[model samples]
Target: MDWIAEMTDEDTALWRSDLGLIADAARQAGDVALGYFNQSPEVWWKNEGRSPVSAADFAANQKLESILRAARPDYGWLSEETDDDGDRLSRETLFIIDPIDGTRAFLAGQDLWCVSVAVVRHGRPVAGVLYAPALEEFYEAVEGGVALKNGRPITVSTTPLDAPGRFAIAEDVLKAFPEALKHRIERVRHVPSLAYRIAMVADGQIDGTFVKHNSHDWDLAAADLILERAGGRLVDLQGEAPLYNRIQVSHGELCAATAPRLADLLRGIGERRGS
Candidate 1:
């Protein structure tokens, strides 16, 4: 059954309400982050110095947590800037958020960062929003609805797999592609925000991207629904969609593209791995 078919009228209304809630909360968090954007908001290293978290991240996370949790006291919460207390796994629906995606880019005075928020039901997202204050772009999607950017509908690129296409992927990952495959694709510059990169694919600005291993739920949950609603797929190598609010919040190598293109990309990756 389709996602909407599985939901009752009350469930659909609730998701739509949740969509509005997150969209507003995301924008508020974006504003909080923007206040620190280029001001060099006190940086701290986490994940053993491999990742940077700034005051802006904390500030925005606080804003999102306060607004979202207060509004939906019954919903569980999980965020990049907050400690995961294992509470979300108990709730049938929960909030997954990244206060400021692309902290490095934000610190570098780049406009690629955003506030990402989603409402996940059971194990999949039912509503999602990505708000880029610097770019003045707001992308939102709810199950059974079209993906929207600034209120306009968006869709993934329809480029055939055989045609040359554009992608935002790491150089090392691209190098592993067979020469024939490499020649048929254009490697776009790296985007620091994985969420924004996937949204680009959703809006047809890029054909697809590869998500490296260790990406957490907050990085993908919001954009996953946006891309899916835009008629694209974000799946792991096994062709399985991600399940959120689980004990393990991390994901392995994944790809995002339109269905047919995703299949071709997966096949190419598999062939390269087998060689």
Candidate 2:
């Protein structure tokens, strides 16, 4: 009874303790990814040509699931590296993850991919971690707590959205909106991993990121929570907060930014999409 009482608390220490456990699991998964890096491991495609999963992804996912489930057997698991299961719906706390967020970048030696993990309570990510082994960076956040990178506190940039600032976007996003190319983005860099891009936004490495439709829940869960915790914003260009655990995992056209004009940018994109 004392152990059960200790696990339940209204204090910050309780949340941190649980988050610390989750962070440890994420770091372990990152190590699994590091082992496969630059070693020419086997790779394969899934869901036609859109999503790719590798042996590295599976390896890391296995480690993550094992560690987390062993710690909290009651929590449900949702992951990009695993098949969808409706059973997760019955659980209150769910583990959402992307074993290798930027598989393409990982395979190509780009070092932008990360292992993303989150503990979603009810419908929101209350705690999360993003571990980029290649960059030696670890970003994490607990509910109502500050965001951090590698144990040091991090904050988002306060620059206005219209100001010249770096932006991470998908390569195909250009084809979707050619006019975006003229929108005064300070720099448009393509990163293969959505979670890392979100982490970069949180860490102030970039001012913003624009993601198109079809990104899955695992891709954005951890980073989404991280950016929010860092005092930034993320939502569909349509102006809706992203949701998870739906039958359709694909999220449509999300834009994340630390700028005050974050809403304006979303409004502008909405107007363009309507026109």
Candidate 3:
């Protein structure tokens, strides 16, 4: 299937309005996060130590939920900090949200955290915004317009697969790649927020990155649209883009990169998967 489709003029205007609404709400959510950034907030763990949540997260989540739901009460809601309702799967459109995508980084006083929100219709993201107040960066996209970072357009890198490049990858995933591909990988680090990592790829701050198994829809939704609009693509290892707000919001191995490099990474890994 095509990554994005041609939108009619009417649809374009509608998506643009959605983008504007989400951006304002996201910025407000970011402000709520700022109130708790770098200060100790009640911290807790989730998924048996696989993840974290803090008071800042809930504050931001409540702010976003109140704003967005007031504006679009009919839209479904799926958020990292909220309990999911089976009702979201039935809506034609919904908001997928993560009030604080990089809680660990935020807790560590790093500037990598962000507020991510997206509008998905028919399983595809039509509008999205990623606002990182700590980093002073805001990335946004609508179906018919170019992606932007703080009012400036953004795009992915063209760094070749054979060229040295920085990547965000799990140690185990990197080790699984063949040595030839491994040699091309450079400046690797673990990023706490999957959304921020994808945003970095869209803005060309890094070459590319990989997602491990079981990343949720809230983690990937907004940034996925930004990367795609910025001339990059985030997709499953099988070369298909993600569909958000499914009956199950979980996803398997995913990758994000400029189009050509994405194909290159997949081919390298697919061949090895068979060996």
lDDT by candidate, in order shown: 0.93, 0.81, 0.90
- Tens-place lDDT per residue, model 2, 160-196, is 6556667776555534543654365555667778888
lDDT for position 188 in model 3: 68
TM-score of each: 0.97, 0.89, 0.95
TM-score of predicted structure 3: 0.95
Question: Best to worst by TM-score, what's the order?
Answer: 1, 3, 2
Q: TM-score of the candidate numbered 1?
A: 0.97
Q: Candidate 3, which segments miss by more than 4 Å at Cα?
A: 1-6
Ranking by lDDT: 1, 3, 2
Among these predicted structures, which one has the highest lDDT? 1
Q: Which stretches of candidate 2 lie over 4 Å from their true place?
A: 1-14, 170-183
Higher TM-score: candidate 1 or 2?
1
The better candidate by lDDT, 1 or 3, is 1
- Candidate 1, 1-275: lDDT as tens digits: 26646788898899999999899899888998999988988999999999999999999999999999999999999999999897788998899999999999998999999999999988899999999999999999999899999999999998877788898989999999988778877999999999999999999999999999999999999999999999999999988998899999999999999888788788889888983
**Candidate 3 Cα deviation (angstroms), residue 189:** 2.2
Model 2 — which ten-residue stretch has the worst lDDT? 1-10
